[model samples]
Each structure stands twice: as C-alpha cells, then as structure tokens.
Target: MVSTTTTSTTSSQTTRERVLACMRDFTSYQATRVALYKEFEEL
Candidate 1:
C-alpha cells in the first residue's frame, strides 16, 4: 500500500510537469504566430 502511494505521487508530479511543458510550448507557438502575422501585415 505504501508503494502504491509513492507511485501515484510520482505520477502526479510527472503529469504536472508535462502540463507545464505543454503550456510553455503553446505560449511560444502563439508568440511565433503573432510575429509572423505582423510581418505579413507590414508587407
């Protein structure tokens, strides 16, 4: 039972980290997209 608890805690931390990484990636992608749009408008 103790092992199961530990395993679940580890899994939860991993999931949180994965979510944060995804958020960072999405934010960067959005910034890149906006920059591209601005460049197009200036053309």
Candidate 2:
C-alpha cells in the first residue's frame, strides 16, 4: 500500500510538470505569433 501511494505521488508530480511545460511552450508560441502579426500589419 505504501508503494502504491508513493508511485501515485510520483506520477502526479510528473503529470503536473508535463502540464506546466506545455503551458510555458504555448505562452511562448502565442507571444511569437502576436509579434509576427503586428509586424505584418505594419506592411
């Protein structure tokens, strides 16, 4: 039972880290996209 609990905790942390990484990547992509669009509008 203890092992199962520990395994689940580890899995949860991993999943959280994965989600955070995805969010960070998405935010970066959105910033780049906005910058490109703004540049295009200037033309």
Candidate 3:
C-alpha cells in the first residue's frame, strides 16, 4: 500500500514538472518574439 502511494505521488510530481517546463518554454518564446519585433521596429 505504501509503495502504491509513493508511486502515485511521484507521478503527480512528474506531471507538475512537465507543466511548469511547458509554461517556461512558452514564456521564453514569447519574450524572444517580442524582442525581435522591437529590434525590427527600431531599424
């Protein structure tokens, strides 16, 4: 029973990490795009 509980907790943590990573990646992409656009506008 304890092993099952541990497995479930580990799965949940893994899912959370994946979600956070995706969010970080999306944010980085948006930031880069904005920077590029700003540079182009300045030119």
Candidate 4:
C-alpha cells in the first residue's frame, strides 16, 4: 500500500543520514590524526 511505501522511504532517508554522519566523523578523525603527525614531525 501507499503507507508502506512511505514508511520504507522514510527509513531509507534515516539510514542515508546516518551513513553521512558516520562518514563525516571518520573524515574528521583522520584529519585530526594527520595534524597530530605533522606536529610531531615539527618537533
């Protein structure tokens, strides 16, 4: 039915948002690690 389709769509949207957030977090973590390495090298 139409309601079932709508529910699935909403669920997919939530999953996509979750994936994007995880990717953002991972990217930031990598950037922080790289910065730390650079600082250590400068010392």
Question: What tens-digit string does per-residue lDDT give for candidate 2 at 1-43?
Answer: 2445467788888889999999999999999999999999999
| Whole-structure CA lDDT of model 4 | 0.90
Q: Count the backbone clashes (under 3 Å) in each candidate.
A: 0, 0, 0, 0
Instruction: Please report, in order, the local distance difference test score of every candidate based on alpha carbons.
Output: 0.90, 0.90, 0.90, 0.90
What are the root-mean-square deviations of the candidates from the true structure over C-alphas? 4.9, 5.1, 5.1, 5.3
Instruction: List where candidate 3 sits over 4 angstroms from the true fold.
Output: 1-6
- Compared with the true structure, model 4 gives a TM-score of 0.80
Two-way TM-score contest, 1 vs 3, winner: 1
Tens digits of lDDT, candidate 4, 1-43: 2445467788888789999999999999999999999999999
The list of candidate 4 runs beyond 4 A from truth reads 1-6
- In order of appearance, the predictions have TM-scores of 0.82, 0.84, 0.74, 0.80
Q: Clashing residue pairs in candidate 1, if any? A: none
Ranking by TM-score: 2, 1, 4, 3
Q: Report the number of the highest-TM-score candidate.
A: 2
Q: How close to the true structure is residue 16 of candidate 3, measured as C-alpha lDDT?
A: 97
Considering summed lDDT, which 10 consecutive residues are worst modelled in model 3? 1-10
CA lDDT, candidate 4, residue 16: 99
Candidate 4 clash pair list: none
lDDT of 3 by residue, 1-43 (tens): 2445467788888889999999999999999999999999999
